[model samples]
Target: MPDDSAPRPSEEAVEEAILTVASLPGAAKTVTPEDVARSVAAGPDWQSLLPSVRRGALRLAQAGRLVLYRKGKPVDPSDLRGVYRLGLPPEG
Candidate 1:
């Protein structure tokens, strides 16, 4: 269980959570930003982690560790908006 009173996760932690959740859906399967955010969220305020989760996902996508999608098609991480999902690279 996470410490409800603890501060929001750091960039590194968010990154790790993104990868961890992405990996769980198996290769080429997707995980939503909310998935990553919930994994590291301190409590019921997981929604507050959205910005950090997006940033972490973008960083991972840039590093070729993950892919970003919108409407079932791949999109540039920097250009992502609204709802999106993350997945491991095809060969992952």
Candidate 2:
């Protein structure tokens, strides 16, 4: 469990961090949910933010702003399960 001092970013903030990290110039790989959580967390307690990060990523994927993958394949946003990575949709 995270101590009261653990970071608790807002939903929007978590989503933004996901996008920011995924869109970094030259980024050539998908980002794990833990990456997003770490980006917004202030310390080791970042693990505590995993739930919020996952929730934000799911919402973003459902909205078509992000893609969620499992086993190297994109999973239905409505039926995600197990470990996943976040990436942006291909640009035209």
Q: How many backbone clashes does candidate 2 have?
A: 0
Q: Estimate each model's TM-score.
A: 0.84, 0.90
lDDT of model 1, residue 47:
85
Candidate 2: misplaced stretches above 4 Å? 1-3
Best by lDDT: 2
- Among residues 3 or more apart in sequence or in different chains, the pairs in candidate 1 whose N, CA or C atoms overlap within 3 Å are none
Over 1-92, each residue of candidate 2 has an lDDT whose tens digit, in order, gives 55795447899999999999999988767989888888898767888889998899889998999999999999888889888999999898
Each candidate's root-mean-square deviation in Å? Answer: 3.1, 1.7
Candidate 1: RMSD over Cα atoms? 3.1
lDDT of 1: 0.84
lDDT of 1 by residue, 7-92 (tens): 76789999998988888745347878887888887577888889999988899899988899999989998798898998888882
- The local distance difference test score of model 2 is 0.88
Model 2 lDDT, residue 62, Cα: 88
Q: What C-alpha lDDT, on a 0 to 100 scale, does residue 20 get in candidate 1?
A: 88
